[model samples]
Target: MAARLTRWAIFSVAVSLIPLIFSFIYLTTVGPTPAFFDLISDGELLLISVALTGAAIGEVIDKKTARIKSRLASGGGCFLVASLSSSYFVVVSAQDDVRKEIVMGMSCALLLLGVISAGLAMAASEGEEGG
Candidate 1:
């Protein structure tokens, strides 16, 4: 189950890149369209966010102390970065200041959660190893 989850996570990450690559190709051939590019970038980032989240969840489910610690740390970190990037794009594209602020706040909260999860996973792993 763990291996399968890891494979799926990897596949999700790879698929997420497809939109950005296609968007680049479309831009090169058809010239620039900010709206279209923004749409594609946003979708790509969201996909990446989901992928990282899946990876982190998978690591937690696996529950192998040492492995879980490293995987959770890396996966959570990646998720946090992706969430921040998504929030930035959301802010840039959103017209309403109120909505933009709300989204940004939520994104920051998610990042904090990711950091906390990573730290806890590490501590749990250490406890398992030492006790």
Candidate 2:
């Protein structure tokens, strides 16, 4: 179950990055429109992903640092950074209502997957130690 969850989480993270990458590409090509700055100046779209990344690092990592735990935590951290940075363009380019909601939805979905991944990784690490 843990392995399954990890795979799902990884897949979810990968899926989540797709829109962000496209957003970056779109912004590079078209430049930021006026509507972009009007909606997301404070970066509210990324709040949950950032918070989840922090919780994963602060709550999961410990003195022992089991291999699975460390890897997943680090991977999540990396994804968090990539997601946030990429999302900047996403929010900037999302001039339309549909695009805005899609980006926000993906961000929240990534956050959910990150939390589940952290929990499952910890569980798997404990299983590793015991059996």
Q: Which candidate is the best by lDDT?
A: 2
For candidate 2, which ten residues in a row score worst on lDDT? 36-45
Per-residue lDDT for 26-85 in model 2, tens only? 776787543543333334435535544554454345424457646575656645654664
Candidate 1: give its CA RMSD in angstroms. 8.4
Alpha carbon lDDT of each predicted model? 0.50, 0.52
**Total clashing pairs for each candidate:** 0, 0
User: What's the TM-score of each model vs. the native?
Assistant: 0.37, 0.39
At residue 99, what lDDT does model 2 achieve? 58
Q: Per-residue lDDT of 33-86 in model 1, one digit per residue for the tens? A: 545434343233443454455455555556655665565665566556556656
Native-to-model Cα distance after best TM-score fit, residue 10 in candidate 2, in Å? 23
